[model samples]
Target: MTEYATGLVYPNGIAADEVNKVLFVADFTGLHILDLVTGKQSWLSDGGGTYLNGIDGLYYYKGTLIGIQDSGNQGDRVVRFYCLLFNVDR
Candidate 1:
């Protein structure tokens, strides 16, 4: 298996910009960026920590990556807008 991002547990799928060739991986833990040509990897975000710590369904729309998350808030059905690249791994 290829390691796209570190500390990313349970990555489901990936999307990319065909023009740019930048790869984006989806994980219940967070999002990871992989360079197609350089083979370099980087962490994108934790999706406001609402990913249930391990879930599924990763999609991209209008240059935005959207996914469902639990956020430790059970019994409540709420959706919140989150900033992309909130937590960048160094």
Candidate 2:
């Protein structure tokens, strides 16, 4: 298979949104989004002031992004992100 992405520190999990043609990748660095059609990579920031880090599992459910995080100081928890809130529909 061909490498679709690079420059990730520690890739852990991924989820795809077929309807939006986008791919969500979670790594040790942060959360990232890849456009399937345009091949554009972008960083996803939490506007709610939640700093995402050390994400290990990713899931896309009903237009929402669910992230399983295993951080050192933050501990283990789940985070939900509304896909439509981000400017990824381009």
Candidate 3:
């Protein structure tokens, strides 16, 4: 198994950037991007700076990554129903 960052306590989604040779993982706390060749991992956004908590799925389309976050909380259902978009090349 690959060793992820300490902060990646709950990884729920995964996607790949073939052209960039990187893997994107959606963790419950944030987004982690890993370099396939170097084995280096970095956070795209730590949950504190962004509203990307509870990411559940990932999809790559036309060079963009779509992240689905579902917290399963009844109170904040409106925010949980949205998907986040990130440019793969950035």
Candidate 4:
């Protein structure tokens, strides 16, 4: 198999949106969205905060990107990320 991505530290969970032709990946480097058609991958930010701590699980449901992250000293919890709020280009 050929490698399709880089900069991922311990990739854990994956969620795919076939209709949108995208894959949301969770890794120690944070979260990223991959365009299946163009082969473009972009890192997703948590709005300029340290809220994202090496996501361990991910889910793409409807229009939301939900993830389970290890908050470090804050413990682990599930978070819902609204793509529109971040102005992510599809």
Write the number of the candidate with greater lDDT, choosing between 3 and 4: 4
C-alpha lDDT of candidate 2 relative to the true structure:
0.81
Question: Mind giving the per-residue lDDT tens digits that candidate 4 earns over 1-90?
Answer: 845578877889888873767778888777877777677788877667657656788888877888887767288888888765433345
Give per-residue CA lDDT, model 3, range 1-90, as digits (tens): 866445676888888874656778877666777866677787775445457667778866666677666655332322221224433344
Residues 1-74, model 2: lDDT tens digits: 74567888789989998576788899888898888777878888766688677889999998888989885727
- The local distance difference test score of model 4 is 0.75
lDDT of 1 by residue, 1-90 (tens): 865456667777656643444666766655567766667787654346544333345455555655554445464332332434432332
Candidate 2, residue 6: how far the Cα is off, in Å: 2.0
Top candidate by lDDT: 2
Error of 4 at 46 (Å): 2.1
Model 1 reaches what TM-score against the true structure? 0.53
Worst lDDT run of 10 residues, candidate 4, spans 81-90
TM-score of each: 0.53, 0.84, 0.65, 0.79
Ranked by TM-score, top first = 2, 4, 3, 1
Model 1 steric clash pairs: 50-69
Question: lDDT for every model?
Answer: 0.54, 0.81, 0.63, 0.75
Select the stronger candidate by lDDT from 2 and 4. Answer: 2
Cα distance off (Å), candidate 1, residue 74 = 5.1
